[model samples]
Target: MNRVVTHELIHAFDHCRAHVDWFNNMKHLACSEIRAANLSGDCSFGNELSRFNFGLKQHHQQCVRDRALRSILAVRKVSREEAKLAVDQVFESCFNDHEPFGRIPHNQNEARFAYRDFQNRDRYNANL
Candidate 1:
């Protein structure tokens, strides 16, 4: 439940902050999907491991890409290869754009800390 909310919220946040052409732009959709998967704890270590997806190098990244590809396919009427291409095209930049969290929240504890940091970001920025 929480994970789903967080994932959709990331999409909402992205939509609010960017001129995302959701219907026409595959890259925009792919970027948001990558960000959502990467930032929403959807690809957290525990989640991945429970899904029997672990032990590989760069597993987190692979998880994000796989999840993002799935998400794009779910909402867009596109071929799997096209969705994957879009995800791959924007994976690096989108995966690295840790906006409100400022980092990837890999677990519940990390997510809590990231939320705290997000809540206090304005204070930190004001001091800068």
Candidate 2:
């Protein structure tokens, strides 16, 4: 397959995965149009994923923390939330004294601040 196709598919897949996971957990049925579009095409994949305000926003926000996932993801031309998720997985994997895939913030100090902030924010939002 062409690299561009791969890129598009990857983006599409990320959009689908993010929104699907988001809605599946939250049951945000109202977002069907945006979710379906995300699954089907790349038209709003980057922007929507970056600005998506549905099911998984807190998770995405937690993962991104204070860091600009938009910029990081733009470098790879991937969705912002996708980058945040990558960072989330990093936290899940690197966190000590917790469940695997559990979103605990830890690691390199300077950079970890972002992860920590994200973790705290998610916790705060969840409680609200």
Candidate 3:
């Protein structure tokens, strides 16, 4: 629950910080959705296992990509072909933009602010 909330909070923060027009910006929307799906446990192994309800099995990455695809399509409000094209366009970059984790931020300003905030929180926690 906390993880999902924080994930969404990060998206909302991204929108505010980047002045993202979520409804129209296909790339921006896809990028954020990709991040949220990758980070939010939507694609986690445990989560996928829990979501499964049948005999046939599938690869974990496939499950993750499918979920990510559905999420992107939902947000883009476009046909599957269009959404897939848009997602495919930014797939590599967005999938690689995992913040506060393995991937790097595409925007330097976002990285700087995130690093600063992380340091501040670390300092405050150490004091406590």
Candidate 1 achieves a global lDDT of: 0.89
Best model number under lDDT:
1
lDDT of 3 by residue, 17-128 (tens): 6676688777777667767776566655556568773223545335545666788766556888877676778777767665564433224454566667666666656557
lDDT of 2 by residue, 1-104 (tens): 33235334533554565444433322222122222222222222233356663244454333223233433444455566665565454443222312211222
**In candidate 1, what are the lDDT values of residues 6-59, reduced to their tens digit?**
899999999999878999999999999999998888888788779887867898
Off by over 4 Å in 2: 1-64, 93-128
The 10-residue segment of model 1 with minimum total lDDT is 119-128
**Cα displacement (Å) at residue 124, model 1:** 5.3
TM-score on alpha carbons, each prediction: 0.88, 0.21, 0.66
Q: For model 3, what is the alpha-carbon lDDT of residue 18?
A: 69
- How are the candidates ranked when ordered by TM-score, highest leading? 1, 3, 2
Any runs in candidate 3 off by more than 4 Å, and if so which? Answer: 53-61, 102-117, 120-128
Which whole-number lDDT from 0 to 100 does residue 68 have in model 1? 91
Best model number under TM-score: 1
